[model samples]
Target: MAAGVARSDDLRREPVLPPGFSLVTLRESGDAFGHAQAIAAEAGAATLVWVRRFDIVEFAVVLEPDAILAEARLAHYLAMNALADALAIHSPPERPLLFRWPDALTYDLGLIGGGRLAWPADCPENQVPDWLVFGAMVRATTMSPFQPGQTGVGMAEEGFEEVDAVDLIEAFARHLMLGVSRWQEEGAKPAARRWLDRLEKVTGVRHGIEPNGDLVATSQHGVERKGLVEALAKVDWLDRESGGPKL
Candidate 1:
């Protein structure tokens, strides 16, 4: 990893980025999400902050939404949808991509990574958010440098081949922009449908999103919908201990 860093520094001082997006390259030691959230107010929309590293691909995108916090969170699903779509670009055909609801993403039935949201503490739920930040991270390669066959977290023991970290991030940004455009043109319904399609399909459970930002699900013959917001609140994101995703 240190060698990669030295090579990157010697190669180009500026990071290559897509159109309409500004890049903020952080030192390999910096936290992409925390940094983006701290400066989102000034960074504005589509500002992508990424940490150039060898073992992981960590990045965040800043957004200025027109809706209040309540409804704005639906954008989280859009971010995940974009992520899955982005991975599909490099994955083999029929590689299963699924979302574990509210948060967490998987590839080919293996836990890979997920998206998260952040906003200012003072931001009011009723007032439209000035800026909303969506961030994501994926483990590109295991750090068990000496033992290539050693098992690691989740199903990461089965490594992906021929794919690089930057490819996924770049693909995600492009797909996310497309999702934002789709939401504006058609509405959240289309986005919701796309998100639902990628969920880990469960039998006999009918799922739907309420207008006020709750995900509701019920058994085929059930009488009421189960509110999913409560479940989503307990996500072990930010790994309270390390203040980052529980890798």
Candidate 2:
């Protein structure tokens, strides 16, 4: 796939987008995250790159943060919470939408998909990078046969047959806008709190998201922190060979 934003001159042909945002649709084989990151410097901000695929909702957005990279990395939490909230809105009211630490998303205890973040590799931690790319994918349909003990589910398999990929992408955009506004108005704590709420709770451990997006767990053994950047480098839900969620 070409590593750049899809030509935006055809904005008139794009779907209705939220204010300050533009859409760049890609073919089924495109990689939304890579394209967004590749052209992030020229795309400016609020450019949403989406891949048209029947079995998954794959998309990425370009962001230009005002804060330093150290502080801005926390925005990953906002994006995660927004994604979870978007899924929750269309999911069954009783269905539990949970998060696995920094990125993975789960529904009713079954693996769904998750979000990812990318910035310039050479960018300093305390400096503001020119752009940040947040990408996410949700399994919409399972390509494989259902096993006797499968632990993963697609949106269609989870009773959301009527909700298509476009619906989820639009929902994510709207929710992400709200999340960004909340962070702008009240700071990162609100987003962090929301993320912590959805995080899979571990008994006897106090969970918190550090300023740099690390996952912190405080217990009787003092404190432990997991680097969000490191965790993001290896997405647990993805199958490297298939370039899709693990089946």
> What are the per-model C-alpha RMSD values against the true structure?
4.1, 5.4
Model 2 per-residue lDDT tens digits across residues 48-89: 998877677789999999888988988888899888887887
Model 2, position 169: C-alpha lDDT score:
71
Clash number for candidate 1: 0
What TM-score does candidate 2 reach?
Answer: 0.91
Window of ten residues with lowest summed lDDT in model 1: 2-11
Runs off by more than 4 Å, candidate 1: 1-16, 145-161, 220-233, 237-247
Sequence-dependent TM-score of model 1: 0.82
Provide the lowest-lDDT 10-residue window in model 2: 1-10
State in Å the error of residue 124, model 1: 2.5
Error of 1 at 153 (Å): 6.3
Task: Write down the lDDT of every candidate, Cα atoms only.
Answer: 0.70, 0.82
Candidate 2: where are CA atoms >4 Å away? Answer: 1-14
